[model samples]
Target: MSNPDITTPVRRPRRLRTSQVMRDFVAETHLDPAQFVLPAFIAEGIDAPREISAMPGVYQHTETSLLKAAEEAVAAGVGSIDLFGVPTPEHKDASGSQAWAADGILNKGVAALRREFGDDLIVMADTCLDEFTDHGHCGVLTTDNWGHTVVDNDATLPLYATMAVSQARAGAHVVSPSGMMDGQIRVIRDALDAEGFEDVAILAYSAKYAGAFYGPFREAVGSTLQGDRKTYQQDPRNARESIMEVQLDIEEGADMVMVKPAMPYLDVLRQVADMSTVPVAAYQVSGEYAMITAAAQNGWISREPAILDSLTGIRRAGADIILTYWATEAAQLLA
Candidate 1:
C-alpha cells in the first residue's frame, strides 16, 4: 500500500564481503602460526640446507641450519617444530639401533632445540625407525613362515619404547610414533613413565595409511625401502578401521592423535576428531605439498591463495594442529 515498500529489503549477503576488514571479521576459519608444527629433516653430514628435488622450497638442514630454522619458526609465531633425522647410509643398520642411541641424530637435534629454544617453542621428535633403518621398514623386520619379510609387531614395540625414552631424555616435549606398529603407544608410555619422564607426551600417528602420497617423504628421509608399507599401515579404502586405530592409540595412552595425508583423508580426520577426547592433528604430507607447489609453479594457480586455502580446509576439517612444510610462510602471512 505504501508503494509496496518499493525498495526491496537488501537480502544480500554481500555486506559481510564488502571489505577486507569485514571479510576478516566474518571468516569462519583463521590460520595462525600457533596452530602449525613444522616438520624438519636434519641430515647427519650436510653443512648447508639441501633441497629435496621433489619438494620445492623445502630443505634438509644441517644442525646449524636446523637451529636457524627453528629460530625462524619461533620468530614467525609457530608453536612447535617436529624433527626427523637422515642418518648417513653407513650409520643405518638392520636393527635401526641409532634410533634409540643416546646420541642419535634425532636425539641430538632434540637436545640442541631444547637448549636453544627451551620452553619458548615445543620440540617434537619423530620416534620411528624408518629413516634410520637399512631396510627402511618402520619397525624391526622378521621372516614369516612363507619367508616374507614382515614387520615383527612384538619385537618392534621394545625398540619404539627405547626410542621414546631416548627422545624424552634428549628433551623432546613430545614423541610422535609414526610407525603403525601395534602396542607402540602403550610400550612408549610405560617406558617414559619408568624413566621418570611422566610429563613427556605421546602424539601417535593413529590413522596413517599405505598411500602413494608418501613417495616424496621417503625421498626426503633418504629411505631405502624395497617395498611398500602396506603390511603395517592401514588400507586407504577403510575409514572405519581408522576409528579403531584411533581408539586403540587413545586407550594405549596417546596424548594426541593424527591422520596423515591431511587433504585426501579429511573424512578420516573428522571421524577421529569426533571420536577422540585428545587433540587431533592432521599431517599435510609431502606429496600433498608437491602437488600444490607444482601446480602453482606451472602458473596453474596462485601459490599464496592455494596454500592458505589448503591449510584453511585442513583446519575446517577439525585439525587442532597442522603439520605442514608451509608453516613458516603461512605464519609470516598470518602475522
Candidate 2:
C-alpha cells in the first residue's frame, strides 16, 4: 500500500499554475477601470495646479485644471471621481460655511465635472467640512468646562445635511459623507429627499479609522487641526465596531459603504463586503498612496506593478469600488 500511494498522486495542485493564461483563467478576482473612483483636489486660490510635496504627482488643482484633469481621468476609462476642496485661509470659518455655499470651490468643481461629462461620468462630492474649517475638525466644535474642545454631533449633522444638499444642487451624482459624525447619513438622506434630490446616492465612509495613516492627507488639505479625531473615527483595535458602523449607515439609507485606508483594513473591508446589501467601496487614502509612491521613487520597488498588485489585492478583498489617487494611471495601464 505504501509503494502504491507513493507511486501515484491523485491530484496535482500545480496544474492551474502551468502558465500565466492558466493562472488567470482560474483567478478568483479581477480588476477593471470601471471599478475605480479617482480622488481629486481643487484649491480655491491657486493659479495653477500645485503638487503636494508629501504626495508626489498629486495636486491641489485650480478649478480650471480640475475640469481638465477630470476630463482626462474619464477619458482614460476611469468610471468616476470624488472631489475634495481646499478653501483659501480667508474663506475658512469656524462653521466651514463655504462647504455648503453655492459658489464653494468643491461645488464649482462638481458643477464643472457635470457640465463636461454630462452624465457620462459619475461625479461625487466629498460632503465633509474639514477642508473648509479653520479648526480643521470634521464637525463644529465647542469648548467644554475643562477647556477641551469636542465636536458637537448634533450641531454637525445639520451642517452635513446642508452640505449634502448643496452638492446635490451642484449636479453631484453622489455625495460621500466622510466626516464620521453620528447620524450624518440619515440626516443627509432626509435632507436630500426633502429637496427632491432623491436621485443622488450616498456613499458613506462607515469604517474610517483614527490612524497615523492620515498624516499626508493633512498636508494635502492644508489642515489646521492640532489634535486627533479619536472621538469620532473608529478605533483600529476593534473589528466588530466596523461591522456595527456599517450596519448603522445602511439602516440610515446609505447607498454605499466604504472602508478607509483600504490596504490596512482589508479584513474589515472583507467583513463589510460580505454582509452589506449595498455596494462596498474602499478608499486607498493619501498616506497609502504616498508610501507606495515614495518607495517607487526610491527605486526600491516597481511603481506600475506595485500599483496594479495593490489594486488587485483590494478587489480580491471584495470591494465593488475603489477610490484611489491612482485611478487614472491605473485605468490606462489596465487598458
Candidate 3:
C-alpha cells in the first residue's frame, strides 16, 4: 500500500514509551528515600502532638511524638531530620538565651535523638533564634543610623556561633543556620571547631528568599514576628544574587547549601547546582505543601502522583537533598 517514492519513517520515539516497564528502563531522573530529609517541630511543653491547622497532616510534636516520628522516618529509610524548637513565651527573651542552653527544648531533642538513633539518622538543629525570640526575628533587633529597626547582622553572628556550639555539644551531626545573616557560616564553623565539634557540619541556608510561602511555617513554630525579614532575606525577583550568597557561604566553610521554597525557585536551584562544588539542597516549604494538600482534598488532583511528580521535578532540577514535610509518606511510596 506504500508508494515506492515515499520511504517509511524509521524514528518512532513512542516505541520507547510503549509500556511502564519500558519507561522505567529509560528514566533519566529518579528519587530515593536516602535523598529525603524531614523537617520536624518540637514544642517545649506540649503533652501531645498538635496538628498544624494551616498545614494539615503536619504537627508541632511533643518530645515523645517527635521520637515516634523519627522512628517512622527511619524505618521508611528517610536520611535525616532537622529539628526546630518552639519555646514557651516565658522562656523567650530579647537575646533568645534559651537557644544556647543545654536543657533547651531543641538541644534536648537533639540529645534524645542522638541517644536513640546513635548515628542511624543524621540529626540537624536549626541554629537560629526566631522560635526562641519574643520578637520572632531571626536575630537581635537594633536601631540603625537611619532610625529604622532592623535585624542586626553583625551582632547576630556571635549568638549564632554560640547556638551552633550548643547544638554540637548536644550531639547534632549538623547545625543549619537559617537566619540568612552574613558572616554566620564562618562564625559558626569556627565556634564548632573551637568547641571540639570539628566533626560537625554546617548546612547554610544560602539562598533563602523573602517570600510569602512561609505562612504555615510561622503557625507551626508559633512565630511572633512583628513585620517582615525582607532586609536580610533575598528578594524573590533576583536570580544572580543567589550565586553570590552560595559562593560566600562555601568560602566561609559551609558543608552544604540550601535553596528554600523549592518549586518557585527551581531555576535558581538549577543554576546553583551547575556551579557549586558542594552538594545542593532544596526545601519544599510549608505553603507549597498546604496548596497541594488543599487542592487534592478538593479532588482537583491525584494526591499521591502529584507528590511524587513534584519531588521528581525537584530532583531533575539538580537537588541532591530535599527537605520536605512529605518525606515519610514519599519514602514509603518509593519503597
What does the lDDT read for residue 19 in candidate 3?
A: 98
The better-scoring model by lDDT among 1 and 3 is 3
User: Which candidate has the highest TM-score of all?
Assistant: 3
> What tens-digit string does per-residue lDDT give for candidate 2 at 146-213?
99899998899999999999999999999999999989999999999999999999999999999878
Clashes by residue pair, model 2 = none
Residue pairs in collision within model 1: none
Error of 1 at 308 (Å): 0.3
lDDT of 3 by residue, 57-119 (tens): 999988889999999999999999999999999999998999999999999999999999999
- Assess each prediction's global lDDT (C-alpha) against the native: 0.93, 0.93, 0.95
Instruction: List candidate 3 stretches off by more than 4 Å.
Output: 1-8
What is residue 99's positional error in candidate 3, in angstroms? Answer: 0.8
Worst 10 residues of 1 by lDDT: 1-10
Residue-level lDDT of model 1, residues 1-335, one tens digit each, is 35656587658798789999999999988787897999999998888899999999899988899999999999999999999999999999988999988777888889999999999999999999999889999988889999998989999999999999999999999999999998999999999999999999999999999998888888899999978899889999999999999999999999999999899899999898888999999999999999999999999999999999999999999899999999999999887
Worst 10 residues of 2 by lDDT: 1-10
